[model samples]
Target: MCTKFYDSEFSFLISTTEIGNSQIIYEEFWFYTEFVNIFFQNTTLQEKEKERKIENVIKERKEIVIKERKEEKERTERKEKEGNGKERTERREKENLVLYKFLLEQLMNQRQKRNTPNNPRKNKIKRNENFAQKENEGSSSEEESNQFETQFQELVDSLMDSNSITRCEKYAELNHNISHYYLPIIGDFFDDTLLAVKNSLKKGSVEEQVLAIRCLLLFSITLEDAADEIFNQFEPLLLKYSLEGQNKLKIASIEALGILSYFITNTGDLDSSQKILRHCISILKNNFIPQNGGHEIYIAKVLNMCSLLLSLQANDFIGIELSGNNESDGGIFFEYIVNIGKSFLEYPDLDVRISSGRLITLAFNLKDRLEREEVVDSDIDVDAIVEIFNKLMKEYSQKVSKKTKTKQRAEFKQYISSIEECIYPKDLITIKSNKIHLEEWPKIIQLNIIRNFLGSGFQKHIEKNFLFSQLFGYRIKVESHRQKHYNKKSQRKEQKKNKKYRQQNITKERKKKNNFENQFM
Candidate 1:
């Protein structure tokens, strides 16, 4: 207590030294000294109380520190256990993946070896079995098949159970299970699987619908022997979704159909493939117009599907052409395709334009290959086709040049030229004059010359200059108008600064006048 009192009074004494009156400062210092002396008498009891409080606080702090240590230890132990559990789980997952991969690899190898034509034992051993033995083996084989089917059904049921299966896991399972070897087995249970897929499509969530579509796509690809029946089942579903579903579903269905077209071709059903192709083309024709809402993505997807169909049917197309089969003649179809693709080249969307360019380029490649090869009679007239292609290229170039700047116009032309060169490698098409480059010239001189020629009645001057301008390269550099813009900007900034300075000076003069008036008052 005496120490605290002395400290406070000493601080007060130092503060009082700043007092202007020496008498007041002296009186304050003396009074505080006397008060401190009187207070020193109770210092012994206060010191004991302070010591007791310090001991009590130290004891409480020790207890708190111990409790915190215990909690920290428990937390560390819990974290360690969790970390170990996670590590163990991760290790097990890695092991399972490795095992699954090894099993899959072994299964694939065995299937390949059994199917290989070079396997000598494959043909020799199966012919010598007795009737009884064959009967017994067939019975066992049927039993195994039953067992396999049961297992597959259970797997599918489990995958479809929303309570137990996540959407991502279902997709992963679909991708993992659908392969060259197991595809046929999966197709054996096609009726139930297709029903499940359709159910998912109709009633499942978005993710389930996508997975179901993927499943159907894989089923189409792998169901070789049953392609006709399965495709008959699938075609309606795909058509419904492509026509009436939401945007994402429509895109998926279109993509799946594109993939399915290749498998359809593989079935050697050219008529069916052609029908599918025609169906796709008809859809594009109906929906590609401006009044129908030309969704660019859907349009691109349709074009892509058409390209896939054409690629698959290139040989068939050649045969049709060579045999002069007008009944199935796709000439009108090709004309429609070319027209659609040419129109799309002018689409505002870059992706739409690119897809259109690819479609046209692919069509040209098919036509050129068909014409150049000796496999066909080469009787078809491609001159009109080539002329149309040239017209398309001209329009495409004009659209591109309009969208690009002067510096990039030449570069853009080169890009277009490269695409053309790739499409027609043997005979390249070169632009004679890009009209965009011709239009952006400073034509003051030409205008004045025309004016003078007209004024002086030089009748042939206009014709000569027009011919020269078309035949020669002449351009004028236009002056930059940016300097005037910079001058105006600087003039505005100077005016603002001058206005600010004038306002500040006026404020200062008003203050000086107020101060002078206050002094007088």
Candidate 2:
């Protein structure tokens, strides 16, 4: 009886309690079975099949949302671009309308003036009779003109509310007081440019200062008359700006000084021209690079302007009479090159690098080696070459004596040698050779590269290249020589035609006479 009871109790414990090793195994197995049943029953579909369907839904929703956001962003951008473009076009149209209305009013007033007589008729009745009618007539036109002006002003006010920059589009007609239509306006404009440039130095927006200085530069290029005051007044302002003005204004002053110096030797005002050149060269010694983000572009351009100014001055001084006073100014040439050399070596820009290199190659061939050698101590060196090369290549940089790179200095030596060794100077100095002298022609090839990099700023390149006489000289030589050839060919062709016509006339006369003789026989 005891044995039977013990066996039954052991079986009951195994069935009900589940202890030790058996408990773990049973707990795992039971938990797995429960998990499998719960997972399958709670899910409405098979696990793998349901997972794929859910995942597809989530991915499609996510993709749709992402695409919507992208499309929304693109729409906003498109609207913004279109809005800006429309605003600009409207502003330009408004400016043209205002300028047109102003000119029309001024002309109408002038016409009324030209018809007026110095002496009035001596009859009081006649005067009183027409006074009311004339007044009404004048008032009607004046009211109409005033209405147009008011509309223009309202448009301008609306535009001004949005944009702070001066909204000067192309002017249909200059303001009545501007005096631009008269070619002889320089005599007056010289004074106006002088004042505007002076005031710009004192107080003006950066753009205003630039425009004012540019106008002064324009005035300095005198074709109608040689005004001493143009250069004379221009110099003091340039010197002041060179010494104390901010970066942008100072650069404008430098460019104006250089442009003023361009070809001024033809006007017999070499002294003042030299003075402008000398002051402009002063910028190279103590240049202003704006402490903002655009340091490379600004300083590079300033240096470029300074270099071109130096070249212009040197061109003037070439074959010119040099005295002790002129010798004092000679040191700046070396400094000018050195400053540009530093920009080439140190500037982190592709355009500046390429520009400085091309300018260096151009200096390669100046006839004055002794002068270049003296400055080579300071201006030409390896620092510049590496600086320039760094802009060109990411992996490689030039390694050489910091002092001896004198890239331009060495180039000057090589150019002088090549020109000196050549048996024919004219052959060595044709447009073709100059085009490839440095493998970086500014126009034929460099412009294309620059255009690819900088779009509308190519106008600046054009302005920069135009400042060089060689460019203009090259164009003029080709045009004028081609014109001469054309004229000669046209003359020869005309002569041949005339000769043929003469022979035909003689044949016709002979035929007529032969007919007469045959009739008489």
Best by TM-score: 1
Per-prediction TM-score, please? 0.46, 0.40
Clash totals, every prediction: 0, 6
lDDT of 2 by residue, 47-132 (tens): 76789999999999999999999999999999999999899878656655644554565556556556666666734554675577
User: What are the Cα lDDT values of the candidates?
Assistant: 0.56, 0.47
Which regions in candidate 2 have their CA more than 4 angstroms from the true location? Answer: 1-201, 219-228, 287-294, 313-343, 368-521
lDDT of 1: 0.56
Judge candidate 2 against the unseen true structure and give its global Cα lDDT, from 0 to 1: 0.47
Clashing pairs in 1: none
Q: Runs in model 1 with CA error above 4 Å? A: 1-153, 164-168, 179-183, 286-297, 315-330, 348-351, 369-521
Best by lDDT: 1
